[model samples]
Target: MKYRYFLILFTFFTILGACNQPISQTSKASAKKVINAAPEKKIPIDTSKAFKFNDNWVVPKSSLDFNSLGDSQGDTLKLAVCGDFVYSPFGTIKDSSAFSSSLLKNFSIVTRTEKMDNGTFNFQILNHGSSKLIFFFDTDPEASRHSDIFKGEIYDEDVQFVNGIRIGMSFPNFYKTLFDSFPDDLTNNYTVVQIISCVDDIIQTYDFDAGKLKSVKFITDSYWKVDY
Candidate 1:
């Protein structure tokens, strides 16, 4: 009888040991899976004063339709302007018959600086035959060896006019904002800032003698360069 009891106890212990072995294997597998999981990549948050200036600067939107004080002349042949110093191919020479001869130019994005800062960008007005137009840079470039011929790509001036024009700016000097600001990792070519612009037909007018000219506005699909 004692021998039989010993045999039963031995079998019970063997079964228990077998069960515990699998538990150990399961725990090891679970730990290994957790170790293989990836960690979240960290993004460098921009907290600089220069970026704050962009807050005060009016990032122009497509909805900012250049308005007119009154009806912009009905049935008159109108020409639309793009944000990137581009004009409608339709000459504003003021002649209905002139409509018969018109060429379309595609809109493209080009960088321009504002009149306020004469540094890399110059905020200047262009006087094309008595009509005045404003130009500003979407991108603020750093001091370059060459003239601020921006590194950002530009739409060729030769392209034909399309339905709309788009303009955007990239701040290449995102890290140079301030002292306490997080250091900018130059290795990562990041787009720290951006602005999108579109061009649309604005209020038309005649000689300044009839000067009711309020503003010129237009619509665009995206940044002038996004040629899809």
Candidate 2:
């Protein structure tokens, strides 16, 4: 009877040891996964409020000469509105009529017009090699009467900012350029930047991906400042 009791006690302890080993190993693996998991990013600034102007805040502009990119105004929306054309790198594109213009012969200019409750909306896509420029126009009779708002998205390197900023620039250089030109804490320590021009009533966002300037978006303030 004494020998049988000793054998039973040894078997029970051996089973307990085996069970505890897996538990210990599993806990270690879970801890390692937690450590290796990708960290979450902080919440971005409230862009809707950013679009609105504060009493103390003024619009930010570029530090370099507006003419550095050749055209004095560059490809600014303001120029497109007041001047009735976009001074694109490929050419000066005026309106949706560009589909049949010389632009189509040299490059592809895809255009589409849609009817809306407000009025007619026109969109143009200018394809140049691997890059492209997309433009939106409010072709409503009354809308165009007031201002020629040329909302554009640029994937090309040739679309220059009046402040001399360009697409495909290094992220550090883009940040530094904005930092030196703008007088605000908002432009500091950011790989991406958004500038709202109250006078122009336009919002421009510069984005960076993989440490390089990716794309630039130009939109009207009234279009984005809403409860979404």
Best by TM-score: 2
Residue-level lDDT tens digits of model 2 in 13-98: 99998987755778899999998896988545433322222232322223211211112122221211211112232244456565
| RMSD, one per candidate, in order | 18.6, 16.2
RMSD (Cα, Å) of candidate 2?
Answer: 16.2
What lDDT score belongs to each candidate, Candidate 1 first? Answer: 0.30, 0.48
What stretches of model 2 exceed 4 Å from their correct place? 1-107, 129-133, 138-153, 156-163, 175-188, 199-201, 209-211, 220-228
Per-model TM-score versus the true fold: 0.20, 0.40
Clashes of 2: 0
**Per-residue lDDT value at 9 in model 1:** 100
